[model samples]
Target: MVALRGRVWDSGVMQNGALSELFGRMADVMEILAEDRFRVNTYRKVARIIADTPVDIGELLESGRLAEVPGIGKSSLAKIEQFVHTGRIEAHEALLRRIPAGLLELLRIPSMGPKSVKAVYEALGVTGMADLKAALESGAVAELPGFGRKKTDQLLKGIAFLEKATGRIRLDQAAEAAQIVGAFLAEIGQVKAIVPAGSLRRRCETIGDVDILVTVDEADVPRDEGRRTMDERRGAAGMGTGRMPVLRAGETLATHKGRTPSAQEAVIEAFTAAPFVDEVLASGPTKGSARIRTVEALVQVDVRVVAAGSFGAACQYFTGSKAHNVALRELAVKAGLKLNEYGLFDGEKPVAAAEEADIYKALGLDYIDPRLREDRGEIEAARNHTLPAPVSLKDIRGDLHMHTTASDGEDAIEEMAQAARRLGYRFICITDHSQSSAIANGLSARRLARQVKAIRTLNEKSRDLTILAGVELDILADGRLDFDDAVLADLDYVTASIHSGMAGDREKLTTRMLKAMDSRYVNCISHPTGRLINERGAMDLDMEQVVRHAARTHTALEVNANPWRLDLKDTHCRMAVEAGAMLAIGTDAHSAAGLTLMAYGVDTAARGWATKKDLLNGMTVRQLQVFVNKKR
Candidate 1:
């Protein structure tokens, strides 16, 4: 009993992410050791289930709810209970002990699965990346069974891709790092404000490094006095908002550089000494760069201390797409002004130094959101006052896709509904998997009918929320949906998707996708491209044809909001919108915490120039019903 209490204390602090990773690593090690394939897949499945679960395992265990989840069998349950009580899975540790720890790193390379690694280890005695790379280059790996010229070539390419992608991190990972680091820096008394800049500010899908801009507290600095200061300074200088006297070509403007020399050192020192920081890359009076540790990876974060007057200018300059900044500077030059991080100026006189909007207005352009500063016709649109109003999180009235305990989800239908209601959603659809996905414990016809009845019962009781019974039906390899129209007609919404046979012929896959959309019962297609960022490339399919068919059928294409699978990416979203197809920003949330991922989907749509009207989720509950009903 004493050991149990001690174990529970340790387990309580282990977050879901850490637990997921632990199981995932265990599976990798098991595969490397040539463990039973069924056992390995079970471990992988449990890892996925845990990762999708937002709630703490200890809490679930305390409530005796963990055992209720499907896909977790007796043995798996034992392992989980062991983990919960002892904060360790001895089975996983035992598997890890059988192989060289470095062998796990080999799995990071694409196309290097456990079976392949096992073969290489046995044949070539390759246990690490360096040894494998040497073997591939020397053409020895090609001589191995099942690895010929073609596969070897792919492995070599994977190695090169891995090398190029090494230091870069995903946007979601960088955001988490920034949040933690920002919280850490906010503790410093000398710090006045913090703002994330660089590609992060622009919301790039992948970030090379993170840049943070801070305003140091100074004696003379005006806090939140940007507009007032701008008006006072411009009026006192006898300058009008209209065009200032044009400076001659090659004439430079003296910029008002705001650097509090007294406070810079203190802020920089505090930033470098942050707890999350792994190594101090560079430190100075105004700038400090460090590699900060995160649950995902070690990311380089550069913090810059700037004066209040130049804060807006610094934000505009550093939160840049290099091409967009270059184009903006060209426009500034044409207007007889000098633009830089310090501020926008006209021949030694500061014009718009305190506000980004003022800087754009002075340049005769509308304010461009940072997300649209990719030089992808946004500047031209701003000049013409024709930029589309991008979709916002508030515009999402409902979530059209999600799972429940009826399938492989960690939460119950009512649980998901309550969570969505808390997020101010007017409606939500319960989209458990159809009967084809045995692995997910997909509902049978009888089970689905019962769930439909249950949803209707819940809908009657839900005064402010509309609950739609839906099924994420599988599109079989032969281009037929897993459930017939008879089974699908009972549901309020249906999301069709390809879960297998993605490696088929391009023409066939395209045909399969088009056929799925033609069904009157199909309301949308989820993760149309079927991709997992950084892990799997998109399946081969004629997307143009898919989009065209979707538009003709009025089928909404989902912008699946899972960070790992932000499918129907920005470019694809734009293409689909241009083709006249609507988008559905579904969190594909397996758990309640997954519901918050709607923001990432919204961000992706905004980046694609999607307006609120372009999204199905952006519609009122009644409007959404009309849309899906029309398809039926």
Candidate 2:
């Protein structure tokens, strides 16, 4: 029987199967060649369909159903069958030979794609990391088609970081590091203002590293002798004595010392001399900016000195989006002037001095606020600017929503109140989770009373900040508050929210929300939609009806500042503002650091064009108390 059995199918059939595999591989090769993502995706789609078809592709071809598969047309099918018959694809092989294999890897670079990589490789013979490094070292990369030294340095640094730690560090982690550095600098007494800028300031989902810029007093510069002594004695005994001598008023030192050194000069020198800096990018006698390459990302620190009056303007100019600044420059150009990181200029000459207000005046516009400086029609609005007076961080007198150990917060009531007082806030409400959500250690009725009593005890000790006992009561499926009116009436503020049954029908959800709004003690709705960004969908609700009801009842809507849940998103905020419903921006901080998230919320509010009048929290401490008392 074995002898009788002979190969029924010829080698052509095997070749046909091999040709299909080759076509699939060729499609991938062509995709990488063209860098046309949409077309590449289409080919990948066809390949996947052919691979996953129920019937054998060979049999399907025999049955003349190859084109019947989705994403596969007659042309594609012909190519597939041809590849199956032939050992190679002539065109694909030719492209493979022409394109350096290393160029394909460059496409993975962030902020750069295939087109840019191809351009770079063709112009500079830079096909991969090895070639790129050699070219950069030889100054060849900088001399390439569109790249300068800045771009070359950036590319090299980026490649190094990518090869080391490729993924972005968590935003919270980056903030933690910035906070540590900020606290250290703040303790130096001479430091006036220290701020974290760049991607962190923009509140990106992830950050590469942290950037902190500090302003110091001009009178704090160390004398040359003092610096030399400190440098020489750094590892020797009496180093501490050297530091003390710099501060001492010795007659010998006074007579010999030159004119007092500039504080700005000293700061510049200190930063350049720091061991943390890998290289000094630029420096000036009185002002300088340098980029420090850290394991995470490049940290750019710029230092400048101006009259105290002009400090705010400098800060605004330095902290910017290039696009936003470019738009400002274009506006200046149209008005027969120029704009730069320093200030507005009249044809390369300083016109309005270093004052931001003067610059705005020179542009024939009301001072375009820095918070609204995202180039989102801000320039146009400035020309005919009827910009709504924005709500400032100072105007926020109270935070109505917060958590404590009763739920997930790390700080106790007293600790949080002290932190809030340091920030000049007038009042804060402790709104812990209600009983339904046991996972968060939701408070039972007895525990709520105990927590309220604790808040009262802390309130008596709180010197400037008022403490409001509140509860973030969870709304049940039937639209009932977690606590009854008796318990709710005992609290200063109540923020009702939906945490479960998110997938409920629209009518049920709307009814649930409406019933909670009817409660006399409920002051606002917290994160109405219950979305967690890319995770869950927002609960269905009749938003128009909900807005109307909130307006009718004088209930406020909360714009939660939690990064993961920027609920009451810009669109919803605009609608709420139009509906005459006041908005509350709360950081929902679990720790002291979380309070800083208020800036993000404020940015979001600005994007929605919310004015001070539209924000319930944008009031003085006394005014906030009056509002709460009136509600009571």
Local accuracy by lDDT, each model: 0.79, 0.64
Q: Across residues 322-359, which tens digit of lDDT does each residue of candidate 1 receive?
A: 99999999999999999999999999999997778888
The TM-scores, one per candidate, come to 0.75, 0.53
lDDT comparing candidate 2 with the true structure: 0.64
**Residue 516 lDDT in candidate 2:** 90
lDDT of 2 by residue, 310-410 (tens): 45445556556557677767778888886765666676667764455787788787876555666766677787977667666666777778888778886
Who wins the lDDT comparison?
Answer: 1
| Number of backbone-clashing residue pairs for each candidate, in the order shown | 0, 3
Q: Which stretches of candidate 2 lie above 4 Å from their native place?
A: 1-318, 405-426, 450-466, 477-480, 501-515, 529-549, 561-575, 589-612, 619-632
Instruction: Let me know the TM-score candidate 1 reaches against the reference structure.
Output: 0.75
